[model samples]
Target: MFTFEAEFFPDLTKTSVSEFCGEELSVLLHTLRRNGQLIEQLWNLVEQNGAIKLYCIAPEEDALEPRHFNRYGLEALSAVLQKSVRPPVFRVIGKTVGLSDACACENSEYYVLFSNFAAEYSPVSCGDCNLPVPLYKLPGENEDEFYALRQWQGEYKACDSLFVLSGVGEKFGYREISEVDSSLTRDGCDVCREMSQKCNRPFYYFLHRHISPLETCPRCGQEWGLDEKLHGFYAFKCDHCRLLSDSP
Candidate 1:
């Protein structure tokens, strides 16, 4: 059985709690606190089965320490444990319960459980790019959430450029542009000329320079390999997809 010891007023912030427990758990806790029946059921389980133990260091007025366990915090934690689906050995250490041993299972076992939970709960795709996006949540109004949101938003902004580039060649009835060819100077080619006219700007102006020559094939999602032709020009080809793009 997995064991967890949560201090009522840890030095960590609410954001840290969310990171430790994960976004799904944090959200579930938020949802459960709003419902009377669920919260009562959770407290009953904690009281009856020793599934959760509650303790307080010292109560203070006018200071809201995000780390400390309050009613909402307990409710959130209970909800998370219930939803985690794995059997957990929990004990609320109060003045009476006395200290108990840490979990009996090895650290590796806990790692596997949490890893499986994240994989099953994480989001499949980003909302903007439709690329894979990890499941994430902002649990509190804290700097941590601010930074996480900024990082996530930055990725979506970067994907906008990638999405445009990925569709450019196809939009012009040209073969999917290899990263190598796209990086080359756009001084020649009817495709570039047409693209310039369509965008009302030089095609190379919008091309991303950081694109790697070795890229995944748009058709088959397989790695593109370098191919040398008799004409001395280099090409990128994917054997699985039969997709080929000659270097300019």
Candidate 2:
């Protein structure tokens, strides 16, 4: 389970499709609705409660140090959000500090997070204000891959490092990773899955999510790398199906 869910669920409603579309991120909500796996995951999802509760966590495996949290969080999670699951632009309520009014619209907004999981200035809260958002919550067996990955990364501490702000490098790593992933999308296919899917013809190695950076290529039964070299040959062993070779 995403610690966010187990910890502060009341802040998050168990959203329905209509409920989902009601949020600021309706476009992405609709996209998730059309995709079977995404829909199934969200069907049982819950939301977190309150802004302040973000500081709470399960016990860390290592002793807590002041800088540890300051160093690792935000850097890691931002990268994961932008690279792995590009969400959409979420606007925050803005205020100008001494001026007693909101900041001007054009200058204050940070639309950088315009995809699956967005991070932007917190518009609503006063003082210690932020909105921690995960694009969708996957629950039960549907959440297995995510929980396993979190555990493997060392759970709370890892999550803090990856998602919270502790280090300079980790802060933008997720965004950097987003650039690396741009190459792996279906549009890069020389034959292109979109055209072929419409044509009702076979296509080259395609991918579906098993987890990050390791996806099973539907046509070839091989695991394509998420790195720069994925399309070149992509003969890596399938993590999902355990199949070998890109040879068809």
Whose lDDT is greatest here? 1
lDDT of 2 by residue, 1-248 (tens): 01111111122234333333244233322332222112112222333322111221111212122232222232432332333223322222222222122122322111111111221111111111112112121111222222322222132233234434546645443332222232322222332233234333322222322224434444444544444433343334343432222222
Best by TM-score: 1
lDDT of each: 0.30, 0.26
lDDT of 1 by residue, 28-89 (tens): 34333232111111222122232233222211121112333445555565655544434333
Candidate 2 matches the true fold with a TM-score of 0.16
TM-score of each: 0.18, 0.16
Off by over 4 Å in 2: 1-21, 35-37, 40-42, 45-47, 51-200, 203-248
Error of 1 at 137 (Å): 9.2
